[model samples]
Target: MMSDDLFETRDSSSREVFTRYNREDRIKKASEKVRQLHDPDFIRKRSFIKSVTENRGLRSVFFVIVVLVSINIAFFVTRSDKNNGRIYGIKTELKSFIYQDRALANLRLSENTKFLESLKESEEKDGALVRVNFIFLDDKGTKLSSSLQTGIYMGTELRFSSQDESGNAKKVQAEIYIKEKLLVLSSKIK
Candidate 1:
């Protein structure tokens, strides 16, 4: 019992001494800071901590502006195509029609579009079968919309024979809607 009392007394006294030492150290540092704050030379001197506090707002504002601008530039760059101007925004560019076939590799895309234009009307009048495909791009040439391999037909859809070419058969038999992403909505309907 006596040893326990001694231990308690020692622990309490040690804790009191430790706290008093910390208090004295803190008081000394605070007085030094107060003296520096009053000194013209210290005020004029540019220290790392001083500069950080003085330009805190400027630094944060500049960083925010830079980040916003970088995001805007990235968005515009990602939404653009080589052959076209701004897309996925305003309709600055007209809609463009592209043609593809088994022999598509033989000719360039421009050549195929030209070829399709000439043949499209003739084939339509003759009631020949034509195929159309679309790709929805997200941005940065990173993500391409893909059709699921459902069965024999890719991007498969069921249609009624009676309703085939039924919507705009008299005017135009084709429709390729891609929001405002292309130039030239479609070849001018004859």
Candidate 2:
């Protein structure tokens, strides 16, 4: 009976020690979990990362839109208009004779005014003449025009003057037409 009591006491003490150890392990696990949940640095880092990912998607979309818009604008700006005809070169020059005689100048001035009035009527019927050299080449044929009477084929230099309704020398422009369609337009200001 004494041996049986001693065995019972040993078993009871061993069970008590196991139970105490199990309780301590459970407390440690719960506290570790709580600590992890309440950590300020970890929470802040997680929230900041989550916010950045959300905003990054929106920012990336915005950046792509901006880049596409910029590309379209550049393309349109660089593209040339095909409707308006091409102009190669424009040149203008003015020449005037000087007279020193006062009485002769006064007599000539009145006559010049009368001549200018007559010239104005004729100018209204025709577009202003511009000294130009134009060449048009296509599958149909080659057409050329120039200020020189010999035409552009001979490659001769020429000059022409244009006048406004007031008989004053002014800017001149001309449009070349083929089959009622504008081929080229050129102008010169003097």
Candidate 3:
């Protein structure tokens, strides 16, 4: 019983000592932290401002580059053939005609015929059948025409048809080349 009392006393005193020591250590650490916070060499305020400005500058530059690249890509995809502006003009006119008045399908078809006839002349002459192909490109790189077809006409359906020398008429290839991504490459069956 006596030994138990002694042990209890010793344990209590040790615990008290440890608690006091920890309190002193905590005070010392807090003081040191306060001193460091005020130290001139730390550059806490200046570094913070500099870092914020640098981060903002980098973010703005990145955003601007993304916007520029997107615009360039849109232009390259929609600009049509610069060499044959007439074809592009015709294409634009057809698109406008079809969309401006939903009832102008016949008018658009007639206009499309003229453009198609002009395009026939530009077909790459192969052995038996003429090959009709165009390259599509963007600021990023060559884009598949099929990829852009969804966005074309802004959710309006566009009709495409091809008539070969044998009078074999078929729907135009669903795939399109945006910037030479090889959306469609039909082989000559002849």
Compared with the true structure, all predictions reach lDDT values of 0.32, 0.33, 0.34
- TM per model? 0.21, 0.23, 0.20
Q: Mind sharing the TM-score for model 3?
A: 0.20
Candidate 2, RMSD to the unseen true structure: 21.9
- The true-versus-predicted C-alpha distance at residue 177 of model 1, in Å, is 24
Q: Quote the positional error of residue 162 for candidate 3 in Å.
A: 19
The lDDT, on a scale of 0 to 1, for candidate 3 is 0.34
Give a tens-digit lDDT track for model 2, residues 25-93: 444457766656655565533564455457778668767888999999999766422222322221222
| TM-score: model 2 vs. ground truth | 0.23
Candidate 3 lDDT, tens digit per residue, 1-190? 2443112234544534432134334444577667566566764445644554577777687678889999999998775432211223233211111222221111011133443454446642211121223222223433323212122221122433322232221112223332223233222111
The local distance difference test score of model 1 is 0.32
Candidate 1, residue 4: the lDDT equals 35
Write model 1 residue lDDT over 91-152, tens digit each, in one string. 22123222331101010112123323434455343222322232223223222332211111
- Candidate that would win on lDDT: 3
Measured by TM-score, how close is model 1 to the native structure? Answer: 0.21
Candidate 3 weakest ten by summed lDDT: 101-110
